[model samples]
Target: MTRHLIYLSIMAAFTACGDGGKAPVQQDTVIAATGGPDTLNRMVLIPGGSFSMGADDSTGMPDEYPKHTVRVDSFWMDEHEVTNREFAAFVAATGYVTTAEKPISKEELMASLPPGSPEPDSSMLAAGALVFTPPHHRVPLNDVSQWWSFIAGASWRHPEGPGSDIKGREDHPVTQVSYLDAQAYAQWAGKRLPTEAEWEYAARGGLSNQLYPWGSEALTTGVAKANTWNGHFPYDTTTTDGFTATAPVKSYRPNGYQLYDMAGNVWEWVSDLYDVNYYAQVGNGTANPAGPAKGYDPEDPGQQKHVIRGGSYMCSDEYCRGYRVSARMKTTPESGLANLGFRCVRSVANHGQ
Candidate 1:
C-alpha cells in the first residue's frame, strides 16, 4: 500500500481557488452617522494593541511555540474571506488567469520534489490544481497522498476538477487559489493579504490569547460555531453543519471583531513567509512585524512556503485542530488546495480615501 501510494503521490501537489456565481452588491462606502453611503468593501477596523502572538496552551502546535508579545498597527480587514462571486467579478473585469489555471511550471514542480528528482513527464505538467479526493477506507495519516490528487483541467472554475462548477456557491469562500492568485485579486481591489500577525490579531476579536476566535474553549462546547468536519476525517463526515464541503462564507456567526468564518470555513492565506524559528527570532513586544524574509520548511526544504491561518471544513479535532486562532500551517505559494482561501486587509490611512 505504501509503495502504491508513493507512486500515486509523486506527481501530486497544490491549493484552493473557486469559480463564479451571483455577484453581491459591493458596498464601497464608509460608515457614517448621517445618511452617508457605505463603501463597496466590507471592512472592520482592528485597533492596534499588544497581545501574545502564539499559543501558550497545550493544544497548540510546535510552530506556535515560545509565545511572545507582539503589537500590530491599526488596520481594516475584510469581514469575510473573498467569495466566489467577488473573484468572478475580478476575473470578468481584468480577465485575470489564476496561477492554478496556468500550466504547472517545471521549476515549481522541481522545487517541491525531493533533491535530484527526475524531470516530470509532459502530461504531468499540464495546467491543473490540487483537489481533495477522500479514500474509500481508513488510510495511514502519514501518507497525505491517499487523500490529495493532482488533476488536469482543475482550476478555479472547476474546483473539484474538470466537471465541477461553482454554480450556486456564490457566497462560499473561493477555494483552489494560489497565494499569487490571492495577491493579484487583492492588488486589483486596492487591498492586500493580511500578515500572519494581523490575521491572528484580528482573529482574536478583542480577546487575548484565546484558543479560538470564540474563546478559550474546545470547539465541542456550542452548536458548531464554525464549519468543520464532523465525525471522521478524510473518510466519512457527518456534515453536522449542513455542509459536506465548503459552506457559504457567512454560514457562521461573526467573531468579536465582526469577522465571519475566522475559525473555520477555509484555511486563509497570509502574507508572511513561513520559518520554523521565526518566533524565537522575534523580539518581545515587536510592533508591525512583517515576518521572516524568506520561507523554509524542514520537511521539504526545496519548497518555499507562506503562512496560512484559520482551519478548513476538513479540519477535525482528531486529525487537524487548526481552527485555534494561533494554530499555524505552511504551504508553497504555488500550491492550491480545495480547502484553502484568503481574505484582504487595508491600511487605516487608505480606508476612506
Candidate 2:
C-alpha cells in the first residue's frame, strides 16, 4: 500500500502529534519523518470514557472476570509497534543489551532449565530466550527449544542472534527486550507503556465485545487479515500469515482505532501488573480503568509479576489463544523473549497541546 494510505489508516484510530495545536499526522512518510529515534511521531487518539474491562466468557482468565465497569482517560498510543530501526536508536544512545543476549551465569541457567528438562547443558552452549519456532520445515514449531537460545553476539542488532543484522529487518519489531528495556525506550520517547485496560480497549478498536481487535474474525482466513499462525499449527504454518516470522510493521490492515498488529504478530508489553482477580476491584469504579495496583502470579515464582497481552505470532487456536483482545498472561518484569515486544502511549492531554 502507498505511504499515504498507511497514514490514513493510522490517523483513523489514534492521534499523537505532541503538545500544542499540532495538526494530526495523516501520512506514513510524514509520521516516519517525525519519529526521531525510538518512537512513531504519530499516535492513535483513544477517546477516553467508561466501559466494561473484562470478558464474561471463560476463554479469559479470572482476573479478567466479573466484567465490571471502569473508566479510561483519553490517551495517545503508537499506531504501530516499535520496530528494529526505532529500537536501534535507543541501543545506540544507551549501549544496552537485552538480558537474553547477555551471557547467563551457570547458576542462573541451571535454575530455570535443570539437567533433565531438555534444556541444553553448559551456559557455554548458549541458551537465550526461546520464542516460537514454526511447525514448517519439518521441525518442532510450538516447542521453543528449536529457536530461542543464548548465542554470543546475539542482541537487538542481531535479531536472529549471531550472524544476523538489522539491515533489511529494520522495519520489524525489536525482540528479546525486557519490561525494563521497553520502559527505558518509552521514557526516552517521552511516552509510557499502555496499561492493560487501555491496551485491551484500544486493541478492541471500539468493538463492543469482539473477539479480536477487528471484530469476531480470526487472523487465519487462509488469506491473512492480520499476521498469525496458520496450517497444522505447532507443526506447520504454511506461511498463511504471508510470512512465518514477523512481517514489516503495518503489513496488515488497521483496526477501527487506526492501529496495526494489535491482536497478533507479537505480544506487546503493558505497564499494569498481572492480577487474575483485578476486575473484581473495578466494582462500578470510574472510567479509564487501570489494572491492579499490585501483581502476583504463580508462574513467575517471584514477587509482583507484570501483565502481557495481545498474543504472539505463535498463537494457535489449539495451543494458544492469546490473540484475543481480552486474553492476557503474566511474566517477570525482567524476562525477555524474541517473540515479545512493546508499543508506546501518552496522555491525550499531553497530545497536540
Candidate 3:
C-alpha cells in the first residue's frame, strides 16, 4: 500500500475469486441467525464451502494468478467492517493504545533503516501514521509520495491528521489501524482476524466463479454497489457512491451472506501473513488452510507483511481495480493508514458449534 511506504521509510513503516456467474439458491441466503452467547458480537454466520481463491481474470495483478480451490470451516464474521463506535467501545473497556498512538522506538528505527543511514531527526520520531493527501494536479502514479504524507498525531482517532477527528463518523469504519491494533481489538472481543481463504470465501457470499461478491455485473453500471473512486483516482474522484472517503459501514447492499462493505469502503486487515507464491504450493481442495507460516513480500523483502482483503474508496476502474474479490495486497503489520480498516472473525470452535 502506498499509504505505508512513506511512513515506514521514515519510521519503519510498514506494511479472491470467483464465480460463476450466479448466486447459489441455498448458499446465497444468509445462514439462520443463532442466538448464541456471542450474538451480541453482531456477527453473521458464514456457512463455508469450497471455492476458487484467486483471479483467473487476466486483469488481476500477478500475485492473484494461478487461481486455486480452497476449503474453509464455517466461521462467524462481523456483519460489516469494524466501525469507530465499536472500536471506541473496545478502547473504553480495555484502555488499549493503538500502534499509531505510540512513538517510534530507536530499536525499530535502526532495524528498518539501512545500516549506513544517518540517525533520523527527533521530530520525525513522533507518534503518527500515514494520511492520504491528493495532489492538486496530475502526477506520476508510480511515486506515491505525491499523494501520501506521514503526519504526527494521525492515529485511528485522528484519521486525516493533527486537526482531523473521527468525531462525527462513529458509524464509519475505523481507519488508521495497524494490524496489531486490530488484533488487539479482536483478542479483547474473544475473536480473531479472518484467514485470507476464509475472508475470500465469505466475501464471495456463496456466489461461485463471479468477478465480484455481487455477481458478474460490471462495476461501471447500476446504482453503485460499493464505494470506489468514480473518476481519475488519485488526481480526481466523483464520489459516485456518495463517499469521497470512508462511508458508513453499511452504506451499500449486503452480499449474499448479508455481509456489507465486502467489496469497498476500506481495505480490511486479515490474519494471514502474505506470500505471493503460497497459493501455488498448497494442494488443490486443501481444507482449512491458514496461509504460509511466515510472511514475505517481494517488493519489500525485509519487512514482514500481512494480507489485506477487499479494497478501499481509492480504488477505481482506471487505476486500481483492487475492489475485485481475488485481488490481494499487503503492508507492514505496523503501518496504519486512513484507508485501511478491519473486521474480526471467530472460528466455530470457539462456541463449540
Candidate 4:
C-alpha cells in the first residue's frame, strides 16, 4: 500500500507536466490590484513577530520536531484559500491551463517509475488528478490507495470527474490544483505563495504554542471548529461540521489574524521545498527562512516535493491529525489532489505598501 502511494506520487509529478496542445506563453497583463484599494479589501496585513515555529510536544512529527524560534516581516495574506470563482477569473483572463488538464507522456511516465517497472497500459496513462473516493466499509488505514483513485479527466473544473462541475459552489476553495497551478495563479494575481514559516505564523494568528489555529482545544471538542471528518476516515463520516467535503470559505470563525480556513477545508501550498531534515537544520532566530533550496524525502527520493500545510476536510484525530497547526504534509509539486489547494501572500515591500 505504501509502495502504491509512492508510485502514485511520482506518476503525478510527471503526469502533471505532460504537454497539452497549448504552447507555453507568458502573460504580461496583471489582473490583480497592486497595492491598491482592493489589496486591503482582499488581504489582511499580518504584523511582524517572532514565535516558535514547530511542535515540541508528542504530537509533533519527526520533521516538525526541534522546535525553533523564527521571525518574519509583516506581509499581506489572502483572507482565505483561493476559491473556484477567483481561479476561474484567472483562467478566463490569462487563458491558463492547469496541470491536471494536460495529457500524460509515456516517456515522462516511464522515467517516474522504479527501474524495471512494468510499463503502464495506455488506459492507465490518461491524464487525470487524484480523487478521494470513500469506501463503503471500514478499511485499514495503512493503505491510502483504497480511497484515492487517479480518475481520467478529473480537473479543477470537474472536481469529481467527468460529470462534476463547480456550478453554484463558487465560494468553495478550488481543488485539484497542482503547485505549479497555484504558482501561475499567484503570478497573475501579483502575489506569491506564502513561505512555510509565513504560513505557520499567519495560521498561529496572534497566539503562540497552540495546537490549532483556534486554540489547544481538540478538533471535536466544544462547538464545531474547522471542517473535518466526523465518524471515521476513508469511510463513514458523521458530518459533524455539516460538511463531508470542502466547505465554503469562511464557513467557520476566523483566526486571530482574521484569516479564514487556515486550519482545514483544504491543505494549502507553501513556497518552501520540502525536506525531512529541514527543521533540524534551521537555526534559532532564523528570519524569513525560505526553506531548503531543494526537496528531499527519503521515502520518495526521486520525487521533489513541497510543504503543504493546513490539512483538509479529510483530516481527523482517528487516522490523520493533519488539521493540527504544526502538522505537516508534502507531495510532488505537480501532484494535485481533491483535498489540496493554496492561497497567496505578498511581502510588504512587494506590495509597495
Number of the top candidate by lDDT? 4
Cα lDDT tens digits for candidate 1, 246-271: 99977888999999999888999999
Query: Model 4, 305-349: lDDT tens per residue?
Result: 889999989988887778888889998777888989999999898
Local distance difference test values of all predictions, in order? 0.78, 0.65, 0.78, 0.81
TM-score of every candidate relative to the true structure: 0.89, 0.79, 0.89, 0.91
lDDT of 3: 0.78
Q: Supply the TM-score for candidate 4.
A: 0.91
The digit string of per-residue lDDT tens for model 2 on 1-353 reads 11111112222110111111112321211112234642343687898876666773678766567776667888889998898778766555555555545455545533443244333345343434443333335544433444333344444555565566667777888776778778878877778999887898788888787777778765665357777777666667677667787778899888999999897788888998876567666668656656677775653333466788888777777656788888877666656666788999999766654
Where does model 4 exceed 4 Å of error? 1-14, 18-41
Question: Candidates sorted by TM-score, descending order?
Answer: 4, 3, 1, 2
Backbone clashes per model, in order?
21, 25, 12, 0
RMSD, one per candidate, in order: 6.2, 10.7, 9.1, 4.1
Q: Which residue runs does candidate 1 get wrong by more than 4 Å?
A: 1-8, 14-41, 105-108
Looking at model 4, residue 245 earns an lDDT score of 95
Q: What is the lDDT of candidate 1?
A: 0.78
* TM-score of candidate 3 relative to the true fold: 0.89
